[model samples]
Target: MTDPTPPRPGSRAGRKASGAARRRTASTGARIREEGAPRVRLPRRLAPRKSPTQDRARETVEAILEAAVDLFSSRGYARTSTNHIARRAGVSVGSLYQYFPNKDAVLTALLARHLAAVESAIHACIPPLRDPAVPLRDGIRRLLELLREVHEADPRLSRAIEQQVGQMPVVPEGLAGYKRDHVATLAEILSTRPDVRPGNHALMAVLLAAVTETVSVVLVHAAPARFGRDEMLDEAVEALCRFVERPPGRLS
Candidate 1:
């Protein structure tokens, strides 16, 4: 008997059969790996799979982000799933994947949004700070007020973002870069102020950024009752000013 005619290289039936085989192989391999190894969930696919420039796409992304924030803040990261996020956002899972590769990427996007908002506020406050006439203490208090507004805006969401920082690689880098920019700006401003003697302005800037961020997060996230908002702000302003405003030759 003649052998059955071979399926053409580009035949639809052949392609379908090949795809089925691949799916089975992938399924088996995934099962074996799942059974053989412990799952380590680091923040992979930290970038979006697709960036939505259209207004409709942007709205979808916003909905997804808001849903993620609510779920992450209420349920915690470990418990929230991409499927849940898609459902909450009222988008299909396929639509969710069109923008984000996974839940971690969603979290990354949310953190990025938060960072942008905070940085915008800080930048807007800088022109006033840069005025040589503005008292250093006044500039600092204004800065402290701006930061408090950001941190206290959604304390639960801020805490949720902090909890995922170590696991997600991009968060720390983003935050560090933000602090570095602020430090450089603060140092330049200090350099122009005759009333201030920021000994090693670079070092003082770093310390000031660190102290302010830590104090703001702690006061807004965990210790609002333990420490009053104004009280914490006053203490932070005092500490930062003391570090930057040395008595001309205090270091010497």
Candidate 2:
């Protein structure tokens, strides 16, 4: 066979080059699919398509959201795909897309839903502090307990959402609004309590909000074994009560 026609003048080399090129292309395509898929284009518009007027539709939305949260907390945002969320939700990808545009949209919706739940919980727990019948220290403890419950719902998911939001180029305006509302609510509650001598309700509210949030996050997500949950709560309550209920003329 004449030595196979001298291997067709670089045919073997060409085959090797083409094979490498194909692999390179495949690798590049995979990277693109992983990293360059659509992100949260409109973070603000992360609402379900039809508002889920029907009970079943609402349930579907909840399922999708819960599945997204589990995936985000466990698989991570970068690794979690819309398809995975849909699969976990037990809904078709088309149905998932009907509600969420992409993975980021689902994250945004989950964050919004979580914050709303927190707000509702805060309203339920903090408002009772406004009652004169409730002792200041007791009220503080109750608020702390309620917050602990909220944070405990899914600490891993909460932390993951926090990190994802932190990575954003801009803070969500709704989050800022929530903070303002919480501060305002706390200020009103403190204003009602005669024992609280903070002198400045707004400042006191801000401080309490900061302290409670920091403590809750630490206790729920990263508290050491030595610092048990109840111990952490007690310490946090003590700190807040002290800060808000200082002796008259003691605060500068």
Candidate 3:
């Protein structure tokens, strides 16, 4: 009878099988490590290729941005392509690429421009808010009005840009800084106000900023016909004032 035993380790068949098993083990180990490892997402290149230095270059960039805004607002960002933006701008695709790296970069530029204008308006309005003569509710109402005006100036564009930002993995440059400045400024102003109840001024400022922004966005983009802007604004002002101006030891 034949030997009822497998090949020895030194034999050719045994060595071949051993090598195949080793390779399988290695492949499985590698797959496990790959599966267990966290994925690293590189930041997107949202910045423009370069700033426009000449009037002609500036005009070309502006045209591309304007075209992108129109397309993004009308067709939506998912439907709008770089080629469409170039054609609408009446510039070559190459020219558009010379300034903006992609449509996202173009949108970033537009958002930055819009934010800068809004920041300027907010800064201008802050002085009035800081005045002792300005009632707390009145000051809050004015800030809300300013936000409404800026958002209403171009509601479609504002909504489109905001929706895209919500989907983005990263905030555009300058946006975080703007928020920090906004919160810091508001906190400082709140701390100085005699009527504002003493607590965490920074936290109050953050809440106020959030409420105003949310109300303004909703009113501009998605408010129902029954919810008039003025009525909503009044309600918001009353609610915020109650929160920030409640007397000490008052639970309500």
Best by TM-score: 3
For residues 172-211, could you state the per-residue lDDT of candidate 2 as single tens digits?
6765477897789788877877888858898878987887
Question: lDDT scores for all predictions?
Answer: 0.68, 0.68, 0.72
The full ranking of all candidates by lDDT, starting with the best, is 3, 1, 2
- What RMSD value applies to candidate 2? 14.7
Over all chains combined, what TM-score does candidate 1 have? 0.70
Alpha-carbon TM-score of each model against the true structure: 0.70, 0.70, 0.72
Cα lDDT of model 1 by residue, 97-210, tens digit: 998887778887777666766787678778877886877778778877887788778888878987786676455454446767788998787787777774777776777777
Q: What are the clashing pairs of model 2?
A: none
| Per-residue accuracy of model 3 over 72-128 as CA lDDT, tens digit each | 898899887788777676566898989877767787777776676567668777988
Instruction: Quote the positional error of residue 220 for candidate 1 in Å.
Output: 1.5
Model 3 steric clash total: 0
